[model samples]
Target: MDIFSRPQTERSPLIDFDFANRRLRIEGESYPEDAASFFGPMFKSLEGFLADVSDETRSAPISVDLRLSYFNSSSAKALMNLFQMLEETARGGVPVEICWNYEADDETMQEFGEDFGEDMEYARFNLRVLDTDVS
Candidate 1:
C-alpha cells in the first residue's frame, strides 16, 4: 500500500510514506497553515499501519527520514507523536530508524533533531546535518 504524495496546499510539507520495503520519508519545508489539523490524519494513518503489523508486514525495520528546514512548534509536537508511534512499533520487536537530516549551517534544526533523538529508545534516530545546495 502506498501512503505517499500529500495533497498540495498553500503551506504544507511534502510527504512520501512508502509501505512497500519498509522505508518512509518526509522531506521539504513544513509550516502548514494548521499544524494539528494537517498532521492528525498522518498520525492516524501511521498508527493504523502499525496496529495491523503481522508476520507478512511490509514495513519492518522501518526507516523514517525527516528533512525539514523549518517547522512551527505545533508541527514539532505532531512530529513527537509520529516518533512515539514509531518507537512503540520498534519496541514490539520491529526495529526502527529515524534519520533527521538538516542543513549543516542550520544549528536550530540540528538541535531539534537531537531533541527528538533523545526521546526515543527502541528507534535508532540519527541527527545528521549535511551541506546541501538548496539554492
Candidate 2:
C-alpha cells in the first residue's frame, strides 16, 4: 500500500492518499485543465487499495477529508465520481466516513458539499466548516 502524495499546484490540489492509515486527504483548490488526467491514478489507486483491504482489517474505518478552497465544474464532476465510488465501497460493507471541509466564509463550498453529500446515502458524510480566512 504505497502512499500517494502530490504537491499542490496553481491548478490543482494537494493529494495525500494513505492506504495504510485508511485515510485520504485532498487539500487546496482543484481546477486542472484535464480533470481525468489529474484524478485517474488517484481513482485507480483507491480501487486497488479497497480491493486489497483484508477481511481482518476491513472493520477499520476509512476516512476521506476534502479541504478545498475552490474548484471548477470539471473538478466538481470528478469529485462526484470519487464520492460515488466511496459510497459504493461503503455500501459493500466497509465502514467509511467522508468529511467535506470548506472555508467558513464560503457558502458556495458549503452548498457544493451538501449537494455531494446527498448522493452519499450509505457513507457517513459530513459537511465541516473550517474557520479559514481564505476566500
Candidate 3:
C-alpha cells in the first residue's frame, strides 16, 4: 500500500497515512465545507490499507494519531467512523493503538478525545497532551 499524505488547509486537516509503516496521522483544524467530500478518499484508502493487514503485520502494532486543533460535528462523526473501523480491525486480532493528541489548554478537544476513547472497546486509546510552548 502506498503512503497517503495531504496538505492541510484552513478548512481541512493534514493527512499522513504511511501504509508501509502501519502508522496514520491526521492533524490540524477540520471544518470542511463538505466533510464527506473531503474524507471520502481518505476513508477508502484507509479501509483498503487496514483490510490488507495480515497476521505477519499484526505483530508490529498499528497506530493512528489524531491531532485536531478543532473540528465540526460532521468531522467528529467522520472521525467516529474511522475509529469504528479501527476498532473492528483491532477486534480481528490486530494490535492497534490510537493516540489522540490535543493542545494542553484545549479542554473541548481533550474532552472530545476522552469521549471518543470511551466508545472504543477493541483498540487501546491514549490521550497525549501536546506541548503548547514552542521554543
Candidate 4:
C-alpha cells in the first residue's frame, strides 16, 4: 500500500500507509472539500492492503499511527469508520495497535482518541502527544 509521498496538500494528510511492514501513518491536517472523495480511495487502499496481508501473513500485526493537527467533522466520521475496520480486523485474530498522536496542547484530538479507544474492544489504542520542545 503506497501512500502520500509528495508535497503536502491542503485537503489531504500525508498518508504513509505501508502494508509490508504493517505500519500505517497519517500525519498533517485533513479537511478535504469532499470527504468521501478523499476517504474513498484511502479506505479502498486500506482494505486491499489488509486483504493482501491476510492472504500472506497469519500473525503479523498492524500498527496505525495518526498525527493530525486538525480535521473537519466529516473527516472525523471517516476516521471513526477507519478505526472500526481496524478493530474488526483485530477481532478476526489479527493483532492491531493504533497510536493517535496530537500536539501537546490539543485537547480535541485527545478526546477523539479517547472516543475511538473506548469503541475498540480488540485493537489496542494509544493517545500520544508530541512535544513541541523535542527539537
The Cα RMSD of model 1 versus the native structure comes to 2.4
What TM-score would every model get versus the actual structure? 0.88, 0.94, 0.95, 0.90
Residue 16 lDDT (model 4): 75
Count clashing residue pairs in model 3. Answer: 0
TM-score: which candidate is best?
A: 3
Inter-residue clash pairs, candidate 4: none
Q: Candidate 4: lDDT of 89?
A: 91
Per residue, candidate 4 scores C-alpha lDDT tens digits across 1-135 of 455332349877887777668888888899888989878877888888777665457588899999888888998999999998998899888999999998878899888888878998999998888878956
Candidate 3 matches the true fold with a TM-score of 0.95
**Segments in model 4 whose C-alpha atoms lie over 4 Å from true places:** 1-7
| Candidate 3, 1-113: lDDT as tens digits | 68988899999999999999889999999999999989999999998988787777877888899999899999999999999999999888888899999988899999999
lDDT of 2 by residue, 47-67 (tens): 899888788987899999999
Q: In candidate 2, which residue pairs get closer than 3 Å at backbone N, Cα or C atoms, i.e. clash? A: none
Candidate 1 clashes between residue pairs 3 or more apart in a chain or in different chains: none
Error of 4 at 84 (Å): 0.9
Q: Using TM-score as the measure, name the better of candidate 3 and candidate 4.
A: 3
RMSD of 4: 1.9
